[model samples]
Target: MHKEGKVVPLAAATDRGARTPLPCLPVLLLQVRDKAALQLRQGLQALFDNADDTLFEMADKAADRFDQHLYFEAMRDLRLKRKSIERGFLDIFYDTFARIGQVDPLGFMAANEPSRNKAQMERAASVEGMVARVLSRDGLALDQLSLRLQTLLECTLAPQHNPLGPAALSGYFLQAGRNLGVGLRVKLILLKLFERYVLRDIDVLYGEANQLLAAAGVLAELPPAPRRRAEDRRNDSRRISATLEPDDIGADSVGQAFFASIQGLLAPARGRIAPRLHAVATAQPIGTADLLRLLSHLQHYVPAAQEEDDFDLGQQLEQLLLRVSVRSGTRRRIATADEDMINLVGLLFDHIHADDNLPHSLRTLIVRLHIPLLKVALLDKGLFSRASHPARRLLNEIGAAAIGWETGSEGLRDSLHLRVERIIQRLLNDFTEDASLFAELLEDFLAFSQDERRRNELLEQRTRDAEEGRVRALQARQQVQQALNQRLRGRVLPQVVVQMLVQSWSQVLLLAWLKQGEGSPAWRNALATMDTLLASILPQRDPQALLQHVPGLLKALREGLASVALDSTATRDFFQQLELLHLRACAGAEGPAEVAEVLVAEDIVLAIAEESACAPLRQPDEHAAQLRAVQRLRIGAWVEVLDDDEPLRCKLVARVDSSDRLVFANRTGLKVREWTAQGLAQALRLGEVRLLDDGLLFERALESVLDGLRQQQVH
Candidate 1:
């Protein structure tokens, strides 16, 4: 049997709780003891006698202590990063060289002659040279690249020197000498450079490397290089090609082939990029110095992260995105990445996409917090959440994807740059009317919040203001259109037709007023007369036989609005004749009388009778009547695509006629059979459209437009 312990009543549980008499030490004895304890902190008995003063002195000391402690914590971070980069860079160097089989790359560098090595040495020497070639073909300037490369190499090779100056290239190698291969024995290097030079950024380093390759005579045009647009062709309106000194064909060509094979070695972090400092002697003849050069880049970049004021970076990124969007007619260079920035950006992937809701000015400041973060700005689909914000989660994304949890590699980097360029262009073109929505939201937040309150009085006032603002904006657009229509409608009939054709196109809104034949009487007469004419008719009568006069009326109004020569009397007679002819097209398939009622409502009665309108497409068999059938023609002949309602519904495509009749195709892979361009021309019923063949060679067209602009000289 388990027995429970007895519990006393709360009042009597403890002698003290029951208010038992206390047994205490003598006051004098206690005082003496307190004094001793206070002295140790500076003595208790006197301390008990003067406790307040002592406590005040100690508080000041504690505050001083914390300030110093904070400094040390910051110092600790700097040391950790310095060490991580130092170690990683050296290891990368050694591994990169060792695998390449450089027997004594370090020693080879010391010896000026062609050192004895495998066939790969000749190839390894040419690596930088070839990479330059490939990049130039993609578009890069090489003259400035050489200096950057030389700087990086010097810093790595001699870490004891002032790396920020000319000695940086050598210092880089010396810092990672062990990894450079057997024979590098440099001491006092890391300490010297750390105290000495500032390193180059990753973009400058890679950019330099690419330049070296291009200078070595390697850039080659690839088959898929976008068809060289003549307007964009490597020609200048008033400039000449710079003199180019070609490299030895035999040496450079062989080098390019070898370098291409080894390009795989540079793929880092995703696939394997062995520590460049570890360039070991092998059949491939890679050098230890070469290894040092490679890892120097890593040392220059890795472990460059630090905590930052995040708010500033977001705004800066947004501003830059806007800048990129508005720039036109020029190619912009995209940076590969800076070493530290890429990691920082990788760390903050989710943050970049997170809704920071910062003020516009502050957004730019936050973006400067991390450069890499900006790389992802506007790239993400505005999707991110609380769970994804953790640092560890972002790091995981980096490890999984070459470019921040998505596909991007060296190959992809170039493509991403191209895509970025297109997105910028598209945005500028599409967003002409609306300024950034995000920008507007931040600016209007206070008023928006006030307007949204549920209180009826405030709500009604805000709603009235908003409605007024919208009405004013719409009125402004209508005013602009009226002015534009008046100017265009008075001249250029073909252009006028394009502008005023009532259809699905953007410019159709201008057609309403123009449909009246530029006269008030014509619209009123047609409206009244047509209403009575359509009052009675059979539902199933054929539509074709009744519309003989309708097309001519539309023709006259079009000509009149354009201020072109036209027979006004004939135009009136045609519409007067069509008063009884049109059947409403919008009326249901049930037939003619309902069609006539809808026709009066459509307000097209006058246009149909006045205009000899061309429709968009025709029957396939009509090809014979439209054109004399040809036996054969070369590929690439321009032909119009066929449709039945509007010529606009028809367009141009490449065509060739063979023994079989006609063949048509477009560059985008559109192919057509059993229809011909001639058939399309005849089929157009209401929209008169025409094709201008090859439509002016690109350069000529541009020059014709731009050459007339007087160059404004700024002093």
Candidate 2:
């Protein structure tokens, strides 16, 4: 526990190396603190209260005994210690507010930072991302609240010391859970619950705090936070700083750090391409602008898709350099920074072309944009640093749309294929010094893609729904057949009765299973009726005993047939035959010619065929590894299925649990294929199927380039 009268450290040190003491918080400020603590107590109560049931549900669904025990134990531990955890949380919250003026917020921040263990860093990054999302989503209310709090405190309070910010709430939660006995996964689960149940609606927390402080005569009419450049703001949001180490330059500024990373990656390649002609007499270095001008001139001359291989940027630059030397009697070389941009852009484009995730047509189009993209990078280094740069985003968007694209017979006429081609052409013909063209083209492409996406999503949803319905019906039919076989497989029954149960009663069972689910009253009643009808038709020790059930059995049969909407003539005929059989059983005489058989060969074979349509073709023992690989694939993953030599791209849209069938759809959401788990495994083993990576294009390229460079160094 914190001491009652301890002072919080100052954010800034005094000249004498002593900290400057802050004034006591105003009474109104103290009131605001109490009010926030009360609201927070309620939110925390909701978080922990819901956590118990969430943990219990997880325990019920646990895959194994150990996971089950872990969840159960966590639930019990949380239940017993929950009240104390809340108390501890509130105590820390109150203590933080009490010392809000005396303590240095940055010191608290540093102290709270998790150590560099990979798991800890990941968890911290997750929480940090949550905080960022909250800030972005609720910036206005938070700003007003911050102003009011600062006004009440008579000083600028750091965000970490705001008492009700996500950072503070997250900090309190982490500390409270620090002593819990749960594993990392459970802790993460609880953290997600905290975010969902608490932070999900945290705007209310800020609004309440702001109102209370404002009512107490704090700043009530605060202006909005000053706006920054939209590009800068976008870049800020895309920063990869959450995973940065404390000492990394990225912790300060993302752009510079990203630049440093690129430089490091490109270190080995620098000056290696079209080496500087320092030995030439009167060799002069060109300005970046002049180099960009040379590139722009070549950008217009980008070869067609057929001739891309023959067009080499390095050789062309060399030829241009030689021409400059002959014409002006002076050799010109690109500056170091300009040369670095040239090499980096070249590497990135090379990676893009080689990325198997993208289609050949799209890759060629993207490669054609290389010169224009390089110009953007040369003009605004943000293209290399910021993932959201318009030029970069345009490429990524194209890559995203092209993930499931195929080179069908439609060739260039495919709408999406055509749209992408048009976009690339526009960039080639229109883009010059105006980088805004990237943004403009990006906007237009996004609009066009959005329209296509909406239509595809609708089709995709319909496809998924249809596939799910088919699976459900298949499962229900199989179940009904199993039920019939269980009761009638070995018994000799009258042919007409057997036909009634097989053809009519089976429909009733399927309807029950589909509409009401297995084990439901409707399903159980249907099964019970079938059993009664079958027993009534067989010989009995006391024929009169069977007579008593005849009326009830007939009523039930009619009801079951009605539920399935069976044909009236068929129903009437089946009932008449059933009645005659009952009468014969009562007279202790043989019924109409029995089928003299049990299982219907045709029906059983049909069921098997229907089921085998989704059944795996591979033997478990022979292809266990491939089967495991197929099982690991999840829905929403894209894959390529090759027929002959042609590639068909589709996504795994749904998995039918009943048959282990995976349903795949093309980009427009039309069902393209279905496979049983074993069948897919066999296909994968035969190299007829391949998984496609659907990650962001630029990011993937960047990672690939870096990995290749790193490996090159190692070798």
Candidate 3:
């Protein structure tokens, strides 16, 4: 009964004088399938977790309200249905494996399946297309995965029949999502996410499954598949594969369009500006290499970060070109291409220097990289033609990080500011003929910023949740106070009744409103009970009506009081006092000082609502536009505030509607400032605060320069 690679053994049994052997092979296969399912379950959990964050980020970054709401709703739907979807996938997987050995060939034919309608057919085609795309992308890994599965089962299985195949996995996911209230684009985005987070490492899944089956004496050994790559990584110029991410498909096209617009401006400006430059007509033009060397030489002398008058790349280049032409006796001129690069770089940096989106300190640090960037641009034209070019991305990353920076906070000591300064200095000190430095720095900076962003986002979410909770509590308290005041103010009542109404009844009212809202039956009942208690305490001519209401009213009061868990002794005393008041009302009498006193006295307790703690509903009419601007600001919008202290940089993390308050957090997601709509509007009107444009810096600069050239051409 021994077998090679067998880890478990079964006892041989006999029944009714005949030998009945167990199906050991099927049992072993089931064990292997279960082990593989466990691995897949873990992977699916991670996929859903990452998907949650991705959807939230998309919602935050969405350009329009419609898209934002769509993503947010999808996120909520996914959260509610995630467990069932995962269960459905595993159920299908387990059932598929269970039927592998038992399924009849004829029974599994197409004739046995139900016919699909037109919409179903279209949806099926779309799902199949998605599966086909995924299979095509990871064809090598999938082929080997299928081979391993077939070897273990000693059977040929089509993709749909293979429990762990891409088709099966996608089919179940699509079926589950069919009922999800999301648009086609969102569905496609989720499919892409599945490819990235789950299927991206599918080879590992099959590898572990194969290993487990082999250990259980199922195909103990097999030939290893040859290694292959999904995409080519070579020195030759080629567009980056769009398969890398969902948004990368159009990145290169956008970059090409930018270059086209830039070249349009450069061509006309070059011809008109050539005669103005005295060096252009001096002598033979120097090669781009010689121009780079001259720029690199001047780069070393660039001023430090704290220098008031920064190093002007254009001024220094002009000086260096003049000296070189004079010393050579035969005047040297910059080549057409080199001259255009210098001019374009100059215009780009000039725009950068004046960009109000970036803080003055960051602008200074970024300007220092002008020479190095110009040199890189001269060496590789991809700087303008490729969005993913290292130099261009590094510049973009720096600008993106500086979007929330402020003028007066930490001149050079800020972590981001320091990191940018270090990178710029490294380029100036190390960069020459080699342009790979940009790529190296880009990788390091991306890792650093990613970790920083994750921490900040966590803190920012907590801040938002806390502010929202505070707002909810304030609103509930205010609602309870209003209800109590409308019923009790200016009315004569006993001190005991007032105390119970304000102290005990107010809690009960607040709890009801907070739990079920103002429109719920519970909130309405709570209000009715307060009114009944007040009526029972005052004089009532209709003794019969008052007598009939006393029992139900007392029951409702006791239940309300019990819901809030007041002290037993206190509850007993309150009920006793209420009973006496009802008795006196039925007898057409009033308690001591019940008619002469009013709840308007300062000594009376009030509901939890405090006017000072809440923001005002409106601001002065003169600041109407400012208020509208504040209202228009999104959650992630960055703003710079100029106060009596240093200028503070922060992003709007939450808007508390109950208080009309805007909560702002710094880059580290620490609550740095907050203001009501009125307060913020006043600040904006007084020129003490402004919004920052957080768009990509390079793109903005290029567009600005192009627009300027277009205007000049028209003139």
Best by TM-score: 3
lDDT of predicted model 1: 0.29
TM-score of each: 0.15, 0.62, 0.63
Query: What lDDT tens digits, residue by residue, belong to model 1 across residues 291-392?
Result: 223323222222212234333332333343334334533222212222222322333433333312211222222223232222222122111211121111
Question: Candidate 3 — what's its lDDT?
Answer: 0.70
What's model 1's TM-score? Answer: 0.15
The lDDT of each candidate is 0.29, 0.73, 0.70
Q: Which is better, 1 or 3, measured by TM-score?
A: 3
CA deviation > 4 Å runs, candidate 3: 1-282, 308-310, 318-329, 406-411, 519-521, 535-618, 622-628, 656-661, 671-682
Runs in model 1 with CA error above 4 Å?
1-634, 637-660, 672-689, 692-700, 703-715
Model 1 clash number:
109
RMSD of each: 38.1, 16.6, 13.6
**lDDT tens digits, residues 270-311, model 2?**
666556564555678788787777887887788877563578
lDDT of 2 at 170: 83
lDDT tens per residue, model 3, 271-377 = 33234244355566778888888988988988887777656655666677668877887666666666666788889999998987888878978988888988877
